[model samples]
Target: MGQKGKKIFGISWNVFVLGLVSFLNDMSSEMINPVIPKYLTDVLRTGELLGGTLMGAIESLSSLFKVAFGYISDRFRNRKVFIFAGYALSTFAKGALAFTRYWWDFLSLRVLDRVGKGIRTAPRDALIAESSEEGKTGKSFGFHRMMDTLGAVAGPLAGIGLLYLMRGIEIERAYRYLFLATTIPGLLSLFLILFLLKEGGQEVRKKISGVSALKSRNLRLFLLVIAVGALGRYSYAFTLWKAGELGYSLEGEMAFYALFNLMYALSAYPIGVYSDRVGKKRLITVGFLISALASLAFAYARGPGTLVLAFLLYGVSIAIEDTAPRAYMADLAKDFEKGTVIGAYHTVFGIFVFPASVIAGWLWQSYSLTYSFLYAAVMNLLAFVMMFWIRDKN
Candidate 1:
């Protein structure tokens, strides 16, 4: 292994520590994510329109702040502070969710939770990138993703146990217990962020001019590709909704989710290694194609077999897209301004998701669930075409 490779992959303690932090944090977040829609619609008696609206608002709004917080971290030459504060804020949000009674209160807590996500995401990602060796970026990112998904796996299982415990309990009461359970892990994540992960000094000393940064042909093209892909990427809540539409029991839906995550975890590292070997663009294009087919299958699926196929394909597509895109960004980013570039990428990408989620929700509410799936399929096709236009020579 080269020095960078050896440094990043061989014996990097920081990678392990950061991965643990994400594992715990994601466990905290995922515990809430899959069940939130049920809580809103079934427990609180909120309409689908309101549920979708809340989800769309939280996702888009959270993305908007990722850029700002990322830039702030870059400018101040600090990563740990933002990371620590973000986790602390998230802990508070989880605690606040336990107290929510009305729809607006739930929405408020959701926004606060996403705000914490926005504040932490870019900075945390940048820190991971900084800690990695140059050539081994994909592996580093894949490792982090593996840990993140491990938490994702744990979260729903935790939710299942809580649900079992509260089997005869009121729905609101169940949520209260779930929220309280999540708080312990969230607080633990904060402690890890504060003490375990080492902070690296900012890589870029001088900020590039805003217009110039935007004008970078490679970056702009890459951002376009990401935005196009994101338009097809609806929220995971929609997936759970789809499972319900197929007459899945709560346990069955959770099992499918667990399977999806299992596939996702297994695929992430291999795909990341593949991207590093072949090229990010090729893998990304394949990812879009796979996602397009999955969306189509989702739209047309009639039985459990087809639904299982769709979910499996969806998991594979996530593996390809998630690992490749960040590695692509890291490849294109100027060494000095990686944080700014990534912040810009995420901010712009996020701008697209707000509309995508709202549109998906509105389509599902107005027409049919099939319409939402079809919409995603069409968007993925367009994204596939856009991917071919960009040159990966940078």
Candidate 2:
């Protein structure tokens, strides 16, 4: 930890800076994210199944690179380079969305953006884990998530505001301009990563196999449970689509999306701090239960009021989902293998994102959107049941 960065709310400087980096990047990402599903459906006219496939492919396909990049970082003992490169790639790729006129163009650019995510996420998380003081791990991660999700909250609101400003323009063109505008924040974040964020003092570089972490029985079983839980962790696009299905305008859906992020940002730090005291697995188990309930609520939501409740619950559930698992993995990992373990967790979670979103889409197209939510609900419950078998490390 750098001496200069140690003063922000008592966390080390690296954690704080990384949090800001995530904040800016997320702001850039979410500006487009809330609109992408609707854009695909309305503007590109891809329909439910194809739109879902494209979204899923964007998420899952790039995720395949996470473990590889993570291990490479571990081998090099250099997190900053990878982190910097990842953000740069995503920034440029996201900016290219302005030129996309077809779904394939959108998919290509989105996949490139996610590939950047894959490169950065694990190493960045591992860096956060390394930056924290021992018992404050949860606090550090929670604070980071709070900052990151604050960006998520801001991004949609910003997008809505930008759209309002550009209302006179054709909708598709307005969306294009918004995508191009996201590059500003992305570049700012990249600048922070390159200049301000500092790595821990270098160690004597050593060659090690990152995948060795997978040999632990506990890690393997925990990963299995995580995979199950991920099956229910469908994309937020589904929720956005639901809002549209229920007759909300684009701005209304953006408001709802902002609301979801608000709850997530508000709860993340507290839940993380609490998990440090009580137990991570307990809260993680609770998160699964909440996810199940939220999914069921989404299935039966009648109007805006019910949708509000569902989104709030879903937000808290996601706060936990986003924070605890990584903290827990950090707790479980050896100092040398933190990047590997965390990367494995991300890889496993992401590996399922495709099937989960696709399944939701399939259910939506073949039966009803109601069944899609029901499937998520059931999968969450199964994950909750499986949680009982895994022991918490810290």
Candidate 3:
């Protein structure tokens, strides 16, 4: 059996280190995430549509830099530096979030936060890929993703808990305190990376353009399909927005949001492990179909019970989508420039996010919520149809 099969108390060393980093970092990000929509509308007075649009815009804009950082990491043949810098930058950005009093400040700081993610994501995934034992890629990446989702699970719970603790304080001021406290875990993640993460000796491969890295016909067509699907896959902030739309109290909505992350965390590793046996392409097609159903569920759900099912479906969709796609990409890309290929994928997908958000916001404001969600369902269904043509033998 591979080292991937031999986990030391359920996690291999390198995957454990990276997973710890993600856990702390996600705890920090998720704390504020559950409350951000309400924060923008209630505190900053940005209103609903603009709040959703801004969230998407910042994510898309910040993610645009991932391709460059990815190429830079490949050119240097050093992943650790970018990883450290990305975490460090985000830590500082998290610290700065509390001082913001305006919408632009929110946008600016949020984008700065994503800057760290943009810089780190591709290189970090490359590290996970490099660290994996042969024939164990699915388990390795899946384990890392599981760790990441674990952080997502804890972050929202911590956020809501903190809010409960500061119950007597003004709500806006309490939000600031939450932002300030998030820095500790964020800093810890960066601190641990300095010790826990290390890179292997460099191989002297010719540097390639990020775009040129997608020489495989499968990768190109795969990316095109993903980008098209991304048009309906707006940010998760919309999920919270939808919860609030359903008349859940802020606290109730936060809990519901946390439930989704919890499900995502639980399912990520198992799905990854299974994909290793079944082949990733078949699982990915199934996930797209699930997402289509989830979208429809979110659209029509009238009560908390129905919404719970919707959120769980969303969680299952996310877990499968997030894990299987990476495994498939790892399967397809050349070892020499996998970081660049992943970066290109993140970049194009992120670029599409801006317009998707805009379209969603427009539809949301101009039309009914039912239409807004059904539109997403329709796009996902189209992707489900297109997934059949992926040319995979599975």
Most lDDT-accurate candidate: 2
Please report how far candidate 3 places residue 123 from its true position, in Å.
0.2
* Per-residue alpha-carbon lDDT of candidate 2 for residues 128-159, written as tens digits (9 for 90 to 100): 88788777778888999999999999999999
The lDDT for every candidate, in the order shown, is: 0.79, 0.88, 0.81
| Candidate 3 residue spans exceeding 4 A from truth | 1-7, 201-213
In model 2, which regions exceed 4 Å deviation? 1-5, 202-213
Residue 141's C-alpha lDDT in candidate 3? 74
Candidate structures ordered by TM-score, highest first: 2, 3, 1
Model 2 lDDT, full chain set: 0.88
- For residues 91-142, could you state the per-residue lDDT of candidate 1 as single tens digits? 8888788888888888888788878878887777777677776776777778
TM-score of each: 0.93, 0.96, 0.94
lDDT for position 215 in model 2: 84
lDDT, ranked from best to worst: 2, 3, 1
Tell me which residue pairs clash in candidate 3: none
